[model samples]
Target: MTTPAHVAIIMDGNGRWAKARGLPRLAGHRAGVEALRQSVKTASRLGIEWLTVYAFSSENWSRPPSEVSDLLGLLKLFIRRDLAELHRSGVRVRVIGERDDLQPDIRLLLEEAESLTAGNGALNLVIAFNYGGRDEIVRAMRKIAADVEAGRTSSASITPQTVSEALDTNGIPDPDLVIRTSGEMRLSNFLLWQAAYSELIFLPCLWPDFTPEQFEEALRQFSVRERRFGGRNERDVVSSSA
Candidate 1:
């Protein structure tokens, strides 16, 4: 099957998965981390060049303070424990989201991961932490306005590409396939602009239960999709006429 060049995941249902099993939500979060690792390995093995995962949203900060701390702690643990293995596996880690308000230690840890794995080329792993697609667009717009204010950019000359370049995912290509777990059919504030034409797959499995086989199944579904990118398929047109 033809593999997608880039795949983004809305890793949902961790808390629910844990609740269903009578385990703590933090346990679900930790299990999701293992699933994430499996996903990265699976994508790499399948020759997917880019994999983006929604780790945390800006709105997630509204959760209980203890829950927020637990999530942040899990992130720190993952970086510390798995970063070296990721580096050795040649994965380039990149984080997308606002960083100005992050705690100094967390901010430094994220930067270090990016800097350390920046040179790796095997597979690009993008973690969307403290991210919201609308917020990302707003931030990009602010950046563009800043440049225009300084006379370095012209408002009249701004194009979609100009706005895209201002985004945190500026150097990254738009995802070809977006897989959302736990049967969620919405983007839930994911890559709103970049995913204007992305093929979406909603799976029944929770994030914690996601496995290489599940990832492969998602890829299999994507392989047969007719991604015209806002255009009509010739075969479809012919079929309709017949």
Candidate 2:
């Protein structure tokens, strides 16, 4: 099978998963963290170069304060408990999102995780915390606008590549495949600019229940699909003539 170089996942359905089991939502979030750990291992073992997970979104702040706090707490625990193991396993951690107004402690932890795993090479693990695709694009535009105002670069000279470089995921390659669990069919504001041409797979399993087998099945589906990226293959030409 053709394995994707980079795979991004929108982890969803934690609250529903918990409700289904008659457990608190926090329980489901905890299980989702475990699923994330397993996914990292699976991706690395499968020789996938990069894996990005949508952990938290900017709009998630609108949730109840208690739930938001719980989610942030879980993020802290995941970093503290798993950072060493992640680094030891050769996973370089990268966080892409807005962090200017985050609490000092949370910001420090995120920086620490990235710094500690900066040299690892087995897999690139990107955590999208406080991220929103449209927000990212707006930020990039602001940067470009600032540069133009400062006479650093002309507006006319700016290209798609320039806009891409201004985004939070500057050096990272675009995802080849995007997977959303709990059967969501939308991007949900995840990696908008980067995943423009990415193949999408939706799995019915909740984020907490995502397994390696299901991930492999998504890969299998991707392998059989042809990606022309807006172009047509020879098969299309033959069919049109016949």
Best by lDDT: 2
Candidate 1 weakest lDDT stretch, 10 residues: 223-232
Clashes of 2: 0
**Per-model TM against the reference:** 0.97, 0.98
Model 1: per-residue Cα lDDT over 114-190, one tens digit each: 99999999999999999999999999999999999999989999999999999999999999999999987999999
- Point out where model 2 deviates above 4 Å: 240-242
Q: Weakest 10 consecutive residues, lDDT, candidate 2? A: 210-219
Q: What is the C-alpha lDDT profile of model 2 across 1-242, one tens digit per residue?
A: 99999999999999999999999999999999999999999999989999999999999999999999999999999999999999999999999999998999999999999999999999999999999999999999999999999999998999999999999999999999999999879999999999999999999999999999888889999899899989999999999999
Judge candidate 1 against the unseen true structure and give its global Cα lDDT, from 0 to 1.
0.95
